[model samples]
Target: MKSHYKFLGTFLGLLVFNSFTLASFSAWIDPYNVINSRTLPKFNQLKPQSNDDARRFKAINVTRIKPKTIVLGTSRADIGIDPEHPVLSAHAPAYNLSIPAGDMYEAMRYFQHALVNQPDLKQVVLGIDLVAFEHREDVGKLDPEQAARLETTSYVQHLPSLVFSTDTLTSSFSTLTANLKGEPVREYYLSNGRLIRFNPPEMPIEAVFGLHLKSAYFESWYKDFQLSQQQMDAFRTIVETCEQQGIDLKVFISPAHVTQWEALRTSGLWSTFEDWKREVVNITPVWDFSGYNSITTEPLTEEMHNYLESSHYVKEVGDLVLNRVFRHELRTVPNDFGTRITTANVDAHLAKIRADRSKWVRRNADVVQLVEQWSRE
Candidate 1:
């Protein structure tokens, strides 16, 4: 009996030690940036796993910073918009709460989280994504993990999944191994809640654009794409919430390369895209940047100087976006780069876009042909 008691005691001790060990490992590696206890170089600072886990990391960040101003959208804004930009100072202490592949629902939840933390939230730069506005019936369900993190006040409630799961352990190992191997840093999450993504230096911009052009994500993105009522409702709520909260808001549509516009037309979603713009204008006056302009029509360069791909632009363009919307550095921004559209002028603005599209389509036959080929694939 004494020996049996001794064995049980030993087993319990080992079990407790093992649990502690696992949790410690998870926290140290911080695979998802949940327990950011120790972020040392060659160990865990740059998080490649983070792009997919953006919702959780971003949710945690808003809780920590409680920023008064924020930019909201998908990876477009995540990669481009600067929280530290001078134009956003009208509403001080801005945070870029944008996440990769984020839909309107996810964006609203994060915005709500920000509001919960900072009730006196001042100003906002809400970048709208046409792709995110589409509701895919195939992926109708919210991710359970992201849903739980957004639901809970105390993130500790979700620590078991983050700190004790086997998958997390795998991630921890992967992160450590990546550091040990000295892998190229693809992305880094800043303390100010902005995310920085790096394209491979060896790869030319055309290759990057081709990768995006051939990307299955974009191929599937416009599949049966229609404007989602739920997403539109969420967008409306975000705009209304700002009005009700006495928060100043600026809205802008993110710009895409001409190839993407041709692809949208090829997908037979051009009418729907135009309708989406009208719907957004109805909700609030917005800066329309997703059109054929000198900026968006920038030829594919040797490096990612202007646009990252057909969809995402670099931070320099984002700065130009801020300057245009916030009415700063007007000399730097071309006149046609961004147009402010309201109920009164939306029709004229869109008509002008159609005219411009005609000219752009004529000028870029090769790009149009490329988009056509990619769409057929």
Candidate 2:
């Protein structure tokens, strides 16, 4: 009887040990979605953080909550365009899937994932960044492991989130800490999936231009850039996929502020810019909005209300682009707002751009000085 009691005691001890082991693993691995199980009061609302890395957190969830229309691009599209805007929502339920500094490869990856998870997606509003097309090696080049992780099917890809992954746990903890302190959580996406500006500066046009002068980021925009074959292949795939799936695709270049144009001109990249427009026209017609135009020249009057900086434009310009593209509220496309580029007329269009750019360069001495400084550097 003592031997029997000893065996029973050992068995009970083992059972208790097993249970504890499993519980500890579960808390660490979090496979049952316990981390986000309880809603934090402050983080209930979708707040898009400005960091590009924050995109990974949103990418998987976007597939599950797929909207009919997806807006894809870099930061310009992230903060500039609102999918929930009335004009976009009127056409279809829309979501902005743009990422900060997102490239063509990332866009394709995200959209492809969305298509796989939600095949009913009907429209793709792609904001084609001109810089994305420069150089073959730079386009779509991700480490093999990272690429594999990014391309995993949505069903399995997001499973890690159900558990206590570092990214998810950190974000949750951060939100909790912020909530406890009554501080704003630095979030990156709205519930509607549009990027929110945490705090936009209210400055005159001169201050805005001065900000650009301090950063030489625009220099690369003008130097030794060329459209890549790989980029073209990726772009063609997106176009072909949209066509095959009966998805309405609207592609446009983002509206760069005039100072950006001046930089390009001063650096002798204007001709290259025209060449890019011509090449893009061959692949598919695009509404070119980058150069000398009323909207772009708005800074001259200190009344260019739609721009935040040389590279960033406000949502109002996005609205104008949408209106021009869809004709939702306007009978005619707004003048100098956007011009559709076609292969048939691209040469003529490019010539006119040259003339306009030269005329502007001659008149704007201050902008010329800024451009010359950038060029010299």
Candidate 3:
């Protein structure tokens, strides 16, 4: 009996030791595999991380990346400007520090985090949205914990090399795991020194029916959303800090479609919010494209007119807005002026396309077809 008891104890100890060894090996191997491997499998269980992750990691890696000008907003600004494009390259080093569905509160938090790591930050291009000013509850989704972690910790001082390395490892792990699991990773992954991803497809009017069905099935959760006043106060604190640090701040209200603008206007709350935005910062160069009502009136080419709502403009329109903001020469103008003028230009461009819609469709038929296929999938 004594001999048997000794053998059982020894076996159990060996089992526990082996388990710890395997867990440790996994921790090291996963990161190593991601950093070394060029191609990783796309897995459905993991949501694919974006190339933006890598770009951001690289930007942080720059030995002296105290960019004088940084762009801030949601995905609209993020996807609009191509970092490698010659126009942006010629300008002061700019980082598109934008995230999907980001709002003013989140932007402010991001600014705070960025400045903490980069003490020499001098200039900022802030993208404002009227909707962001309105009461919202979904703001909690902005990952405040991570932002707070960055705020409290002197990330640069402790792990100078670890800052870039941690970012790289995290991004690679997230992406590789996501690819292994078939998931809707945000479009835009690096391929052959360029970003590539499936484009949104053109949908027939019949597609609207499908959308309606989906909407009906999912209960609307908009009512539960409410913006916290405390968070707004936090943003104000960030602005104050920037001002104290002598950073030049340029605020921009990115363009949106007219239909969307009208919806906001009707919401009774939007007007009050607009007033709030004006009070906080200089309201010039508002990149409001929401006034372009023609695209909603009639569809142009499937490729050009593929957006389901005013919120999602085609890539062409996105580029046009970027070109005007970054490259166009203009006199010293107010924030609202940029939006008004750019809206007119966008309208004109759309009107010209509508004049010969068939010709435009033919010219972009291949792209349109690709878009259509993507939508179906």
lDDT winner: 1
Candidate 3 lDDT over 1-377, as tens digits, reads: 99999999999999878756544433332332222123434522222344544333323322234444566666555655444444445445555666555566667766766676577777665656554543565554545534444444332542323323445356446645665665554465332112233343445533542352223211221223344565566556656776789976555555544333333333333444444444444322344443333333334334445243344444444455555565443332223224432332544533432343345445546534533342344
Q: Per-residue alpha-carbon lDDT of model 2 for 182-268, expressed as tens digits?
A: 654343455556665533345666655655644535544445666677777778888889989998999999997888777666656
lDDT of 3: 0.46
Tens digit of lDDT per residue, candidate 1, span 30-101?
877666576888888776666556777788766666689999998889889999998887667788999788
Reference-based lDDT, residue 328, model 2: 66
Q: Model 2: runs farther than 4 Å from truth?
A: 1-52, 90-92, 136-138, 144-146, 155-159, 177-187, 198-223, 300-304, 331-333
The worst-scoring run of ten residues by lDDT in candidate 1 lies at: 136-145
Clashing pairs in 1: none
Candidate 1: residue 286 Cα off by (Å):
0.4
Q: Return whichever of 2 and 3 wins on lDDT.
A: 2
Q: Relative to the true structure, how large is the alpha-carbon lDDT of every model?
A: 0.81, 0.67, 0.46
